[model samples]
Target: MVLQLHVWGPAFALPSIDAQCLSAIAYCSIALPKDAWELIASSDPSVSPTGELPALQNGSTWVSRFRNIVDYLRQYSDGAWDLDRQLDESDRADNTAFASFVESRGQSLIDLSLYVTSHNYYNNTSPAYGNLLQWPNQWILPPKLHGAAKARTDHLGLSSLDLQAIEEHRQRDHSAAVAAGKIPKNLIQRPRETVSGLLGRGSSKNQFRMEALTADFFEPLEAMLGQKAYLLTLKEEDVPSSLDCIALGSLSLALVPELAFPWLRDAMRAKAPLLSAYTERLRRRCFGDSPVEVAHAYSPQSAPASPLPWRAPGRISIAAVGSTLLAELADSTPFLSEIRRNNRLKQAAADSDLTSVEKGAVSMFADSSKKDMYVSIAAAVGGVAALVGYMFHVGLISVASQEQEFEEEEEEGIPDFGNLSAGDILGL
Candidate 1:
């Protein structure tokens, strides 16, 4: 089936900013970063159904959200890299719990880092979408996404304190008046409250929120991952778990240099070595540090990069072929012919002599030794052809195989992480 994944793209992995989308796209079989993301965004609402990016359209099936998308992908790929493929029921439950916990605690912090934090937003996240686009899109998209993202964060009462504080104060006054047996009026006219007077966070609280949320997330992760390869390892020596995929996809954004919050990044760097190590391990295991994208655009400056185009997997592109098709052809035929002629001249210098002006005037035999040299040249051409063809095959296979890096293992499982309260896990 033709699998087309529509996500915000041209920047970050899977081409969009959302980490949940990253996890889902990472699990798909035929997933490639779609370059014309704005096209998808501008199209019908039915494309997404939920009015969200990262919607996957597979045959007749359509789904949104990372968890549901992954469930579908597991079936689609026949359990390839399917975390729940061989796990027992209990482990599966625990996996769900862990994912829920991480999402609850970490997703907000991610939003704060990208949308709310001024430093990271302009430097990394806000401008990211536009930077990936061509001229008009570059002009149009950043403001739209920025406005949408800011509106959501503003509603959280974290960023727009004045507005939230005003609303809250008005509500408080109305409640007070109703209790005192008078109808509330002119509450908003006074506008006496500052952000500090309300429950909404101010500058100090925003900083504290960053630190607190950072602590809430990584502390548990560090303890849960103590000296282990996998998050919910069945044995002490298992590779990364399904939970690891989600965790990595979510937390990996913090390490993103542009999107990274300086305070939170430092906190993770200083206090959460294990969690830091976990993301590093997952990056290597899942991506091998490479993803192939069909998207024509890439964000070298502000967005995430596409997997670099390559002539082969192991072979370097420059070594395999020249930059252009004509250049490559010249290198193979004319270039090879010139090299053979030079080699013959070098041998003659050491043994016999050959005239320098043997060409262009004396009527150089087009093929004086054509019959004998035909076999040798033909063999040389065949060797070069085999090398190119093999490299092409290798590149094709590498691109396909890389879509899903983690394999479904049989007859093994990861250890369960029992339910624990936030305070107990974070040591708060």
Candidate 2:
């Protein structure tokens, strides 16, 4: 019997890179049974409880959330989808951090696209459908007002909508990106494009936000490429045994296309074939005739002349209690030892001195100085260590808290798994 897989979503309308990556995985020969996959585009809430695109159902199991979907596919695929197959804990952590950054910020790109589409960019001269409006708002606005706004909104089209959406998405995106250690905080306010007079000059602020957001990923990209020749590679034999394929597949879809953006493309040209091939394939698949224009349209400012290499840089901030401890240990070990040695010399000087006044003064000075030094060092070290411990405790608590969140999210995302049955897809 043929394996049956159902992907329910308005995937075309959503146009999310992450969602597209999920589609790619679903369509990959190694991951899905031949010609057995189907995509359902209905908006019925019952079809996907989360009201999100890209929920997957196969046989007796239902999976939602991109990470869980990747995990579930890896189990049966023999780990073909594993991204961290060869990575150690630190490397894996780095990759996870990078992925989280991409996932969180990538939404901005999607939102920009949606905003444009809703504004009626394509057939605006004489719209087939009324002017598309904002998404969450469009879902509720009355039909009459939407029609009246059509001309003005359509004139603004994709570019204007995208510009605004990028600006709006940037605030939340930057906060999340910073929290993930993706970008420096300074870039958060940089300016780029100007809004037309009617839109007001303040619109230029939005452009700056996009530039700032894109800057964060540059270092991570350089780091990944600098470490290995292939952007990410998995042995053909291990395709089914790891989730590396899924992660690579996702990253390839997400970052590769952005290369066409002049700033990003120029930066990636050092590894031309890898970036070119990845972008070309996606352009052909998604944008077809207008690949070059689409690529350039999304381009940021020209790439930097010498981008920073990806090894961790800058002073370690004690953002979390755990990091504080690590920072303290890293910063104080040598200095603390030096202080101890210096104290020993001072004590010897006190013992050998002939003048009682001098000896007493030295003793008093040494006593006060040593006490101060010890207290200062101890406080610094102890504070950091305690912070580090507290950070870890908090992280664990957060993870536990998320367990229920994930379940609740899942419950709202996919239909009940209990309703599914074995042999509904592949018998195995």
State each model's CA lDDT, in order. 0.56, 0.42
- Write one digit per residue (lDDT tens) for candidate 2, span 106-225: 433333322232332232211311222223223332232234333334432334543445567767888999899899877747574433432355456644544454445444554554
Candidate 2 global CA lDDT score: 0.42
Candidate 1 C-alpha lDDT tens digits along 1-428: 44556655535543346676556544442233333112122211223545455677766766776776666767766776465665678877878888888876677667666665655666666556554444344554566556655665564546643243346767787888878978755445555544334334356665575566678888888888887777777464454456776787677766644444355567787879878877766665444454423243232333233332111112224422232333334435854555555544443343222356654222234334443467778888999999989988779767656654534332135433467677877799
Tell me the lDDT of candidate 1. Answer: 0.56
Instruction: Estimate the TM-score of every prediction.
Output: 0.51, 0.38
Model 1: CA > 4 A from native = 10-15, 29-50, 77-81, 134-144, 151-157, 160-206, 234-239, 259-261, 290-428
Residue 403 Cα positional deviation in candidate 2, in Å, after optimal superposition = 66
Clashes within 3 Å, all models in order: 8, 27
